[model samples]
Target: MVAFDRPHGMTPPQAQWELPFFNQHHHTLALGLADWAGAQRVDESDDRRACREWVHKLGEAGWLRYCVPAAHGGALDKLDSRALVILRETLAFHSPLADFAFAMQGLGSGSITLGGSDAQREQRLRAVANGAQIAAFALSEPEAGSDVAGMKTSARQADGGWVLDGSKTWISNGGLADFYVVFAKTTPDAGARGISAFVVPADAPGLDTSEHIDVMAPHPLATLKFTNCRVGADALVGTVDGGFKLAMQTLDIFRASVAAAALGMARRAFAEAVAHARQRKMFGQHLADFQLTQARLGEMSALIDAAAMLTYRAAWMRDESPTQGAGTPAYTAAAAAAKLTATENAQRVIDMAVQMFGGRGVRVGEVVEHLYRDIRSLRIYEGASEVQLLILGKAALKT
Candidate 1:
């Protein structure tokens, strides 16, 4: 039995989240979420069904309320970045699918909260906050994965409305979401400045989602095609040429939480490694007795510490950073650093934990095995590690 009180040198690995960066509310939120997540035995068999169920469960528990503001179905007066970080971190530790479900709700409706008209906020964000609706963020297209400016998806003015015609692939909650926050090119000649955002219901007349995507760690992904999908003038979100900035703003807030989720997965793997090392023995001594094992454990602990601190700093700074409701240079760079470091470190840490677990680690249904697969996508999604490096390098050059 491990002492959670952290008396003297008896601190568990999870005690790291209790660092000075967090306040009473943050601590309370983490402890409460830990209890809730621990009690949940997840079944992620049907990616679509599992995502829907997770969303339902999260909504029922009132945790989904944290995704929006209090005035329109939320627990806080504003979108609390720190609270979001804690929630994602805890949920990811238990079930990555759960984290994905919870995250898309926030990501899908984030633009509305930041830039939506009052009516749009009520139309989407309120429903999203209550778990009455599932939300999807649709920004990536077949020709435009990392390069947002290269998107071929366009929304043209017609009949006092707009007609969206193109495809968006690799969309989270694509087939499962009740509504999608879609970014389209309104000015075909203006490049990135030409983009616009819209709130498209899943049942929209011209939308099709027959194409399903199977990923290594699946949680409801698909390709969306809009064949002359028309929407009224009211469906537009934010300014006509401001979708890129809106999307960036939305991502900037959640990017640090991605790091936090990675941190949580890394923490779980570290705990399992510690438990296994202490119990397993070799050459008439426990595995923890070996010098090399001790060295590896020490190194793992150090990596976790570095990642946690960076993630925490990034999250808090995001909450505090001032900007034009777009994004801050300081926060943007910090978020990129945190995401880059945490996801890459999680991959390494989980790999080491699997190695320590020996044959059991690679076997199907093993915790470490799931973690290995789960961590791989984080490095690729949100923004690839290479893209993060470019962001950091560019930020450095400007500074």
Candidate 2:
């Protein structure tokens, strides 16, 4: 891991945390995290190794506590969306991989926090909180990316246990996780309703996680093949046929956090561009002195602010609004809007930053160049831009 440098004393803006959407604790959390994240450096030469190091550091620093509840060694009584947004945004600003490591800890085990039995909670939650074990959420298959119901993985009752058979692709922490909350269809013809969730240990027989996927970014992903992978009855999570709701609930909590991650990347790009402008000389003057440069910077700042507002609003709605939560049209629409705008706007902002850097922008190790690749996948994951558009369109029609 090479040392990360911040030229021109550039840091993510903290003024945004004072918005009404955040409380004193949120501000404190952001400030503390910014200081911590800015000082840490991991050799990212190997993505997997670097990810493990990040997780270990985050867990040791008590940052992973935010990923769970106080009962399970978390920092709060419940999962707080605003807090999650703050954490993801701050981490992503410094290193997108750090944000990824932090987010997956919560997301991979979210279902258990919401629906697991007392035994399951006791066994996994604390370990996850302390980094004794890693976790993964396995739901998407080769045929099912956003369409959850299209998954072909199936589970059946066998010899007083459950057997899972099928393949799960695009699984984050795939080969590295200690356990996976795997979703498979228990009722083959029931579409979404036929599904169920189970906790499958990574060492379980008949499970394959050797197929790693290389993406444009540094995220660790893999394809999992389970052929008659059996687990004890105690491994079942939630009620039968309840996996769909459980999965949706898990995603709901993290959806806005995704937008926050995008917001962080955008904020970083903006900071980089501004610092470059002030120092870069062109046409017998600094880049910042040009009217055209100022206008472009103005556009980038506005885009970041817009995305920030929507992302914060969505997180606030989830954490504070009585009418919020999974299946609530209002929160769903807000999250969809936030995710759509933050991701799309971040892409544009980063692209603009790259343009401003000219030939230097695409250089291998340049911050803007790295950010250019890091910001692309956010637009496609968790729910694509097109999906968010359809959701917004449907919400408008209903209104």
Per-model TM values vs. the true structure: 0.94, 0.98
Per-residue lDDT of model 2, residues 284-369, tens digit only: 99999999999999999999899889889989998888877555999999999999999999999999999999999999888889
Cand. 2 TM to true fold: 0.98
- Candidate 1, residues 111-210, lDDT tens digits: the string is 8898999998887777887788999999998989989999999998899988999999999998888889999999988989999999898999899987
Question: lDDT per model, in order?
Answer: 0.84, 0.91
Clashing pairs in 1: none
> Where does candidate 1 have its weakest 10-residue lDDT segment?
1-10
